[model samples]
Target chain A: MDEIPPVLLRILRFLLERRMLFQLLEPYEWWLRRKYPNPPLPQFSYQVTIHTIRNLYGRRGKIAWASLFFPSEFFHAARLIPFYPEIAIGLVAALRFVQTPLAAAEKAWFSQDLCSYHRGGIGMSLLRLFPRPDFLFATSSICHGTVGFFEVLREIWNVPLFLVDVPKQWTRDAEGYVAEQLTAIARHLEREWRVHFVWDKPFFFSNRTREILLEVEALRQRKDRMLLPPTKNLDYLPYYYEFLGEETSLRFAERLKEELSKPSKTLPHRLIWLHLKPFYSGELPALLEKLGLGVVYEEFTTPFPEELSPSSPLKSLARKILWASEILATSRGRIPGILEALKRYDAEGVIQFTQWGCRQSQGMVMLLREKLLEAGYPVLFLDGDHLDRRHSAPEQLRTRLEAFLEMLEGRGSS
Target chain B: MCTLGYFCRYVPQELLEACGFKAVFFKPDFSSPQCSSLPVPFCALCKTFISWALNHREFSGFVVPLACDASRRTYEILRALSVPAFSLDVPALAGETAVERLTENLDDLARELLAQSGRSFLEFTASLKQALEETLRQQEAFFREWGKRRRAPDRIPLLFSGSHFAHVLLPLLEEKGFLVFPDLPENRILLGEEPLSLTASPLEDLARFTLHRLPCPRLSGPARRTALKRLCGTLGLRGVVIVFSKFCDFQLYEIGLLGRSLGLPVLCLEHDTTPSFPQWETRLDAFREMILHG
Candidate 1:
């Protein structure tokens, strides 16, 4: 399990007031930049974190709590700082501070079987750990849990919740429906935040971010070696989802490409990662290294070349959400995409990490395994909860991963 | 007529009937061998339905709604397995466009089912018109009887709501001397208080009626609380009993707020594939005492 710094833990535990916490984050931000100055990519992430924190609690502007699927582009255009409570709770879990919040959530009748991230979020909300939101926004594109999770938060905070319903299929009518909702949200934000809403700013940043991420993706495909750690790509998930329309994200993407362009050692075995890895610990990364397997591509950071148009911003964003992997994962739509990524990256095996409570991804596992095997690739399925360390079984995971790696090596040799 | 099984209440049974199919609500059963095939974390109710669908291949088809993640994926699994299934996309947000979207989806489904039955458009329309009229009449009669039951004295009137299982509890509640007014999505089919009309566009009316019905937990807004509050007033409900399957996301998230919002003594029960009937009996016994004595 990942260990939290003793000092940081003590500080977090004792910091009862949001104002005091906000004040302490200033030094914490400085300490982070000072500690991680060599690798600018991690520094960029830290900077975004500090910026998000300041925007959320610093009272600099309006803040809208949203699901990750709610494209940050809209918030950027409306000048509202977007705060993803799920992602925030995920960070708390990674920091190993989720236990208290999770317990509090359960006390409030949040079941143990629901998504842990959501449970942690609710716990934090009940404990008043999060800032009050001007509003809550969510998209029904990823998982139904998001909608319910945000609805509960809306009740807790007594805020207006805006929902953008993205259909499973990408028809013109569906796109129009989503675009209309997006437009309504935009108008609502403009009136509430006292700012004129325009898509030009968000469109420019999204287009640039997309281009850079595509380059980063190309670098991954072209490089025969895995330069970074096994779970390094998973770190870019937040950037891809939450900062996709921000300058900081564009800088991070460019820096990531530059970092990946550097030459590194090639591993004996290469695998493609499906879904998310256990983010609460470094054990999986350690195991992958020990087993001499390098992850060439992670599905969450799989970059698409679609361009955002300023002319019809809502429609384009709506189309993007409709075609997102989470929505398409229900059908056989993601299978072709995964197969293409596998061939492009030239990975030898697939590892599907099934996060607990994620029925959308778990439901697709059997079909994914069948299709990948039929295409002459082996698959190893690993089950773990991303946000809860209680579910982590290091011994079992190590044994399964070791056996899968050995089998892959045997297949390659034979 | 062939049978078309469904689990969600949003699916228009009238349309299915018009297409020469009997709309059967698939109740949760625990004995299917295929239950083990689903992911372990899936809610018990969805697992039961998927297991049953996998084993019972004799049904003409099944209609799966886009109400929840489990149900949506159930549709995906059934389709992948080559089981005859139809996915009905229900919008999560409510609005004028949302109603129109459901109407369009209903139209698409009507067309597909009509083609499957090898019936002409005019014949399907005529049947749909007639089915709508009959449905409104039947639902009206159900409400009238429910009203009379509500006025009956010396009985504990309890509102039963949650994820669509534990219908087994309706009779059990009655056995326990509780007047149960079921407010579940499946029960809403016959309990819809909205008066639907048969017009040139009967599909539109059906869509409006379904959307306007007591809002399910999956639907966005506080409309669910509002509708339930009105129902509580209308029925003079004394308490609530929410029965949901294990790991049901919608119910788990909504039940707490619902209980608190209702401002009444509430008992929330969790059902698994193998529910502990004795434990429920003990809890119900205690709940009965509290309601009757207090």
Candidate 2:
């Protein structure tokens, strides 16, 4: 093969570095669409996934899987390979390969009335697109999706599965439950993997956790500041999901820090979009950018870090898991965390993207808006879908976002 | 004639009837046809109810109890659609305060219904109270009959999945030779009878029971293990029939976990509001076959 184009090479490097072709394909999504008309080579995709998995396992010499959001860092600390299915599902949804396997999973269970995420996840698993995780762990902070997803995987793969049950509201007991589950998971891993995870290394994990969270916080803060007037924060999406882990988090932090130190770019206003995939159709950020407003942060990308107390690994893990689980207790249960982000970033307004039929997020819209408003933040609740782009009221969302940004700017100037 | 839709083990039909509405309880079909079309996770009882509402236009309004997060959020969705809806806040299973709260909620519901329907609260309350009393009495009688069947040396005590079958269906199952010991109303009610005197929030108590008491298909390992232990110990159930709604992923996901946790035979029945009787009948026959042969 002749020298790959610089863009192609960058894509390949990204994929190889992430140890997954999907990660590489994620950024070059537009290219993939342009190159392959019909169903992009299934064999090729499968080969890439298999190759990535083998590489990951070979490198780590351990079986580990990272769940979405909080439990991910704990998995990383355990020295096991980490994989975020939400990231995979997000990529698939973005790439529009979600429909087929989602349909298939629905057919298997004779269910047509489930959430598309669940359908897509089941679809991905059925299609063998999702690498079989050796150990599966998820925090019940968001929805029944985590529980159901893991259970299905357990049944199919007979893999050791763990569910960290987070209550709808945060409480001491809930936190205790999380700590307990984390310990249980740790114990399970100790027995299964036969590798004793050092419980006394408190500073390493806690410090790492603090560092990652602060970095994430800084990124959100910087994005908010840059979103001042005509500037846009289009680049935040990839940075949020792709650069979350320890390996790339510091680099992302530095990049964001460097950007923030510079003189503020004049933008329309600073607004926070709630639970929105900023890169939907790769147009949201561009559209908002064009409208002269910058989306500073999203509720989904809150800088809630998962830190386990190595002093008592199991209990600490449970506590951390419980803390993580607190996310799913209510629709806007994640709002407090977001509010923290808003305060840290000095965000002016908030926009909650109420994706139609997303019960978990949709139900919390009113509560979230109320909370945001009470906190002196103006909130505009917009309804749309991530998977089915047709359901998106782009004009409506744009108008709402722009209007909110304008109000924020006016308030800021006054 | 206005048609009202509701769900649960014991739907208050008299209240609906007194308000000049035809009350219909539609169970969710968890099978393929209905599951794929729905946008939210089908595990939520409210989603199943609302999806039915969206697809069927005949319903004038919906009546739902603030039972769980799913139902509460579902009410929001309904409210947004401009659907005339009423939420009856049931007290969590705990204290005198809980009972007081429930009675107050019921009174409020009665007043709201009376206002909306131009009906007398006294008349509706009297009718509803009588109907509820009748249901409690009937349930007592049914429980005794079920107990008798369960005690029968020849009949195997069956643990019917609580999340799957409604209370109305339990009596029907008991009548059909299956000794149905559902994990909800009967077991939870028994467990929750003791009035909690502590200062713990009644809503928390209710949430706990609703979250932990009912056999949620999405329970973690410990919960699942405990449920399996309880199913084996308390019920002495020879087998379990997972009466999962068609699109409900929770129970289906738990099938393997439950199977592994308990070395028992499990037959999954994925049904919806349509009641696909023939398919269930076939599954039941097969289940019976497994019970007898295996």
> Which TM-score values does chain B get in all models?
0.92, 0.60
- Interface DockQ of candidate 1: 0.69
Across all candidates, the chain A TM-score values are 0.91, 0.72
- What candidate 2 gets wrong by more than 4 Å, as runs, is A1-54, A57-60, A110-113, A167-174, A199-209, A212-245, A264-266, A278-280, A305-309, A312-316, A327-344, A373-377, A388-414, B1-294
Residue-wise C-alpha lDDT for candidate 1, range A238-283, written one tens digit per residue = 7887777878777788888788787677667778888777777787
Query: What local lDDT does model 1 show for residue A349?
Result: 87
Candidate 2: docking tier: incorrect
Tell me the tens digit of each residue's lDDT in model 2 across A1-414: 212344654564454445444444444544544565332224334433443445453344555444564444465456565666656666666565555655556556524444455555666566555655677776555555555666666665667776654544456654564565566667777787775654334335344545655654565565435643222332233334333434444444444555565556545556666665522366666666776666666555454455545566555555544554465444434667778767776767776655553556655665666667788888877666555454667777777767776777777788
Model 1 chain A weakest lDDT span, ten residues long:
A1-10
On the 0 to 100 scale, the lDDT of residue A380 in model 1 is: 92
Model 2 Cα shift for residue A244 (angstroms): 5.8
RMSD of 2: 12.1
Residue A95 of model 2: what lDDT? 60
Compute the DockQ of candidate 2. Answer: 0.15
